[model samples]
Target: GRLVEWGGTRQIIKEPRQEYTNALVSVHEIEHQEQKPGTTPFLSVKNITAAYGRSHVKVLKNVSVDIYPGQTLAVVGESGSGKSTLARAITGLLPPEEGTVTFDGRPLANRLADRPKEDLRQLQMIYQMADVAMNPRQTVGTIIGRPLEFYFGLRGRQRDARVAELLDKIEMGKGFIDRYPAELSGGQKQRVCIARSLAAKPKLIICDEVTSALDPLVANGILKLLLELQKEENVAYLFITHDLATVKSIADSIAVMYRGEVVRYGAKSQVLAPPFDAYTDLLLSSVPEMEIGWLEKAIKGRRMASAGN
Candidate 1:
């Protein structure tokens, strides 16, 4: 017979039957309470200027961003806009020439070898091409089990069970465990990659166009699965994609990049609203609208707008 205050309203705390629900609510509230003080960013890239060679043709130009806990920051840009470069920098594949990357308040090491394995485990990347990212010769079990074995030191039946658990988490059943990469379809292959990324139990996952290769329906299913995993795991995602439709569905915040610069960055609702940036307008207009002849209209409108400017 206890009264509980929830959202400014008082309700009677019911019997022990409702304990599970009450416990969940309490946990949710505790998370909010823990977040009330707000720690420093989980990952921070500060004014990073990177290049491929000594001539220093800058691929990323003073680029800065943040990845916080339990949120998806979708980075959108056309090809050659430095999106993948940014991801590589975050994962320690490339070193910045001008700035620093800090993970959980410590500066990221300049080389992958210099980074501690535990630090590497906190940040994981899911590549666009599943075929290239995964080992074609390896079975799904071996592919997914490698991370668990490497990071957690599990092997034999333990590793296999963990792989099976990861597969189930990604909506793939246990039957596919023994299958090879060539045996599965594109979507299933990507799901296997997802399982591998999840195997590390990473705090942050950089999904570099993870769903782009699949058909729309299959991609949607993958996105839904990602949302479910985020809910259960508290995983943060740096989702890099050119697909505005996907961004609208999954992004909490969006950063629109063009020619290695952030043209626009804000909450999804704010950035997608009217008074859009010229590039953002062009990007939004390019999405296949339900109305017929939308592409032509968008193109003509952009041309006219450009002429006026």
Candidate 2:
């Protein structure tokens, strides 16, 4: 593919001189009001350091972040930047070599199996691939109802009722109850995954690139649904993504990670405002704008900065 134009996303959309690029950037944008963070963070990951088993290499370097109740704290970075590793650490999939994860005023166990049943129930996770996350043999009802049954011991009609309610909550309605994963669209399957997480009535949901795999329109719908659910359920989110656009749409706070280190962290407005850290600036500048000579201009500016330095 030929590179035509590149700069910030808004610039790319509004000022594209290339017809090809203009056509590409034309899509609906999601508007979100930045929410204020509460005084107390319900989930605190303090100075976490982790590494793979049998390896001396540290993948996470003193990383830490606080997620307020009912808000979204997005951990953003490109691949191999420890975004997912941080998620793994918090979920106890990979226990940290150092530091602590505190939830709801109590310290959490370092490993998933060691955590109490209540801890597992209250801290839920939604992975990127909805298709693989659910079992193909299970009906949508069964997938969503399993959590309700597991967490609250709801069975039979009660579980089914709760499943239908959750389906409604995800805006999928109750019609999908009988469908299998293979029968559903990508977005629909993700919605079902979301409903399953909500079925547990979690206080915090770790959304690891939940919208990155879907079409833009479909992803926006999911983001809207998530925002709506957060409002209604008051469930906080640790939203992990590499997409800055997605971060702008949903994050109340942000933690910018690079090579296992948190380079920047704060409220959405502060973190995104001017005087950005080097990596954050690079990430923001790479958003691909629609200007006629935006790419050339950006390149020139970067070169000039490099020369001056």
57-134 per-residue lDDT for model 1 (tens digits): 888998888877877888998899999988988887888788899887889897788999998888888888999999
lDDT for 232 in candidate 2 is 95
lDDT of 2: 0.90
Candidate 1 least-lDDT 10 residues: 28-37
Clash pairs, candidate 1, are none
CA error at residue 245 for candidate 1, angstroms: 0.8
Prediction 1 TM-score vs. true:
0.85
C-alpha lDDT of candidate 1 relative to the true structure: 0.82
Q: Estimate each model's TM-score.
A: 0.85, 0.90
- Counting clashing residue pairs in each candidate, in order, gives 0, 6
